[model samples]
Target: MVGTAADADELLRHVDERLPDVVVTDIRMPPDFTDEGLRAALQIRASHPTTGIMVLSQHVQRRYAVELIADNPSGVGYLLKQRIADVSTFCADLVRVADGGTVLDPEVVALMITRADRDHASGRRLTPRQQQVLALMAEGRSNAAIAERLSITEKAVVQHVSHIYDHLTLPPSTDDHRRVLAVLHHLSR
Candidate 1:
């Protein structure tokens, strides 16, 4: 079923009635035009356990991504509004979220990686090459993609990822969004 709300309160009210399988909302909506949608999304996540959330924004706001995926990365997705232009890909992402998968826009991931590289708590400890691999990982790239981007072998990419997890002190997580969360956790510091 599909429903619409003008503001965060209305959205919550709608959710209170019956949770939808997925929610696709813009980051800036209603009342304040600031983070109302993001705040509301978080509330929904806290209140409704089964619903999936996909937040869209014109700009890549790292904080939104971090907060949404902070506790549980599953059933969550954050994408730039432009992604909607490619209807097939956008719908596929939403479907992935509904299926308890996590999807993050590459731009958002890149932004987080860039910010983390500058001031993340453990970023300084990462070798520049490791940092690049982490950034590509944050972008949801496969080991193959990382290797192709860096002109390194897939085995090397795997090694870099292991080191990134080690340097960040991330206890191994099977969560699909672990890579993105690693970047988010760094930026959160």
Candidate 2:
């Protein structure tokens, strides 16, 4: 694998040249250490839609998650540095992103879900159970996982998800990440 500690400019250059299938970068990088990597990630995604990006940060930044996920949820991930402690899961998540799957840090998902449930008008329309389902969905949980967590049947999870889509006015989509984007859209508004 090609590796470098370069700034966004160099990173972009490499991406342009290599067109690697996956990129794992820290949110903060050289020359400013602010959001250079995040900016580069956005540019890389815009320029190379097929590329996968995983942004790792020391802390949870809601805005970072919002911007990266707002436009598209596929082939992207936002994880905290602590996640690497579970190397197997972290590596699996990276592969999942490279394979066109969305992987969100649980903390980031909680932040968005809480904001949506507590403040968003659309969230106000949802029942408490529906809100719970939405939170799991935002975490990139499948219907089966949500069901196991909530101690409900998968069929019930499906029904709750349907209600969430109806309340959010999101048309049904086959894409797995659609629910995540929908949740973020509600939070953003």
Candidate 3:
């Protein structure tokens, strides 16, 4: 909440003046109102790698979501405006993004899962439970968070994540973030 702007240009100027830990912007802004905000966000991400970005939009726009996280999924989020109804959760999501975690709206995760299910060309199918775990993973949930949400043990969540990696044919990585990125990349395909 360091600064606010009416349009993308002003937003960029404000960012230049004083970079904030996280930036929450709409997908559309003044002057054409057609992805100007997203463009500005991409510019900011390019210039300020440490700054987190969250795009709150009314529309689904899967392509836009994919583009935002294409190069770097860390510290990025794409959430629907409807998510603001839960103020605490929304605020938590902002904090997570600021701390270099990727967060996608539940609706976005649902759409991605639906699309992935529809296009079953990957040859490896995930179990229903695996799908649920993957959805939470895409939402940037840690193992403990996923376990709590699923009413399971953290070790069980870890097992599901490992199975997901095996099913998706992702190479084993010591970095948890890389595992999330690999899963996200698979879903986006």
Candidate 4:
């Protein structure tokens, strides 16, 4: 449902009485649209550990996405509102959340990566190739697409991305998609 953090709390309190299994909230709402919806999502995760949550936002709030799913990713998802214009896709997002799958918006992910590039420390430390890969990845291109964009082989794109991740000291499981998010998080700051 759509509501503020306080409203969500109240709804949860009431629903806790009924034992619901899923919750969805917009990442911005009411009072101030500065990640309050994100706060509510986190609170739901904290108070109802088994409950699944899907947070929708106008933009990708990487910080909120990290906090919401970093500890326990199962049954958690984050999507941008712009990515869903039809009910079928929206319903699918909720289903994914209920099934413990992540559904991050590609645009949001790209935005986060671009934001990361702005970080003086990380940006300056990366090699030109690594930086270029990072930028292309943020554009939501797959390895092949990135390779085409950079006039390299897909395998080469993967290798360069691997180097980029290694230089950033990112974990192996940090999917290129999320690596972009992490980069964006750093850039945002």
- The number of the candidate with the highest lDDT is 3
RMSD of 3: 1.7
111-144: candidate 2 lDDT, tens digit per residue: 8767776876888888889978887776667899
Return whichever of 3 and 4 wins on TM-score. 3
Show the lowest summed lDDT stretch of 10 residues, model 1: 175-184
Q: Largest TM-score belongs to which candidate? A: 3
Candidate 3 ranges beyond 4 A from true positions: 174-176
Candidate 1 Cα outliers beyond 4 Å, as residue runs: 140-154, 171-181
Off by over 4 Å in 4: 1-6, 28-36, 59-63, 123-161, 170-189
lDDT of 4 by residue, 55-122 (tens): 78776567776676566666776777876677897787777667665555666555655556564577
RMSD of each: 3.0, 2.2, 1.7, 5.5
How much is the lDDT of residue 70 in candidate 4? 63
Q: Rank by lDDT, descending?
A: 3, 2, 1, 4
Who is ahead in lDDT, 1 or 3? 3
CA displacement after TM-score superposition, residue 92 of candidate 3 (Å) = 1.3
Q: Higher-lDDT candidate among 1 and 2?
A: 2
lDDT of each: 0.82, 0.85, 0.86, 0.66
